[model samples]
Target: MKNFPLLIILISLCIACKNAKVIIDDPINFNDQRKNLTLAYLKNRYGIEKDDPTIDPRMIVLHWTVIPTYKKSFEAFDNPTLPDWRPDIKNISGLNVSSQFMVDQNGTIYRLLPETIMARHVIGLNHCAIGIENVGGTKNLPLTKAQLKSNIWLVRYLKEKYEINYLIGHYEYTLFENHPLWLEKDDGYRTKKTDPGTDFMKRVRKAVKDLNFKALPKN
Candidate 1:
């Protein structure tokens, strides 16, 4: 009887894992206005030799959109031009930054862009990195436990789907300054950022430790 109970619990867990879902609520598209801009940005900002924006992802970078709600986050990235506040880089390329996936407060995962297509999320690594942005992390709207679970699942999913090797937070992105993944041509065009918090990353790393993804090089 005791062994039967354990078997039932194991079966239930397997069923739950099998039925796990990450819905695609919205997708940001490259319309007539945005396509040419994206191509120009790819070449000017990242110095990509080819016209194609497709990327063979080598790393996964996580971010938290301080923009409280999913609607606003989507609206903010809908346009292809950089916001006026960022005058420094706007001159280089009018590319508005975006990510591959976004996790809302309730854990709904949205695909903003294609995984193989480049997104201007991580400054130096957009050429070979995939970015996942969470909906809320500001002082007013903090991230939820649901988002943490979603991120853990998403990371594992991406690793299985792609040739992803390194998993890093947005803040840790600067560590790749001189690494091959860092594709920016200008040495001075760097921004300091701390996002998705240290604790959040620690928890994610602990959860996905079994995946055996490589850590950022110390050099």
Candidate 2:
């Protein structure tokens, strides 16, 4: 049958497309100033005096950028220093908030920083957590199903590549404050968070149930 070879080719292409990941290398500004700020944050906040601004990545923390579009989201993290509007956090450190990966509403995953590098996304666990931010989490522009799928895929990919033992929503970071993983020195320096809401995290965690990430410490 002449059509047999054509069918096989079609099937192979379908499989490849199905398994293909849509990750883009859209990095933010991580110049010398950012590196120095990160090192300072590590030392002052976590008491880690490392020469490099890298982390072991024992956890993956998920977040949602309240900013609507991918472009705006990118701009928010493009700078190395915290913006003026965030004076509350600027008092602590000048390092801008950033994440390792950001998932667009259409499910396009963008790598903003190196996975092993410390990002100022989460509060206490930035020293050992890789942050994944999803664009659009406002009441009007909630996260989409495409983002959910992309997050699941990213979680699996990171888990396979790193020694990640925990997966948590940004809101869940406070629960680890007393856990051994937390390292922030200033006990009063905590911020409230509800990004990447409970529903989104529940769905993602359900999908990756087989990964068996350690349970979040009881609040």
Candidate 1 per-residue C-alpha lDDT over 131-217 given as tens digits, one digit per residue, 9 for 90 to 100: 999998888898889999999999999999998999999999878887877778777888777888888999999999999998787
| Best-fitting candidate, scored by lDDT | 2
**Model 2 TM:** 0.94
The number of clashing residue pairs in model 2 is 0
- Name the Cα RMSD for model 1: 2.6
* lDDT of residue 40 for candidate 2: 98
Model 2 lDDT at residue 115: 91
- Model 2: lDDT of residue 140: 99
Scored by Cα lDDT, where does model 2 land?
0.94
TM-score of 1: 0.90
Candidate 2 segments whose C-alpha is farther than 4 A from its true place: 1-13
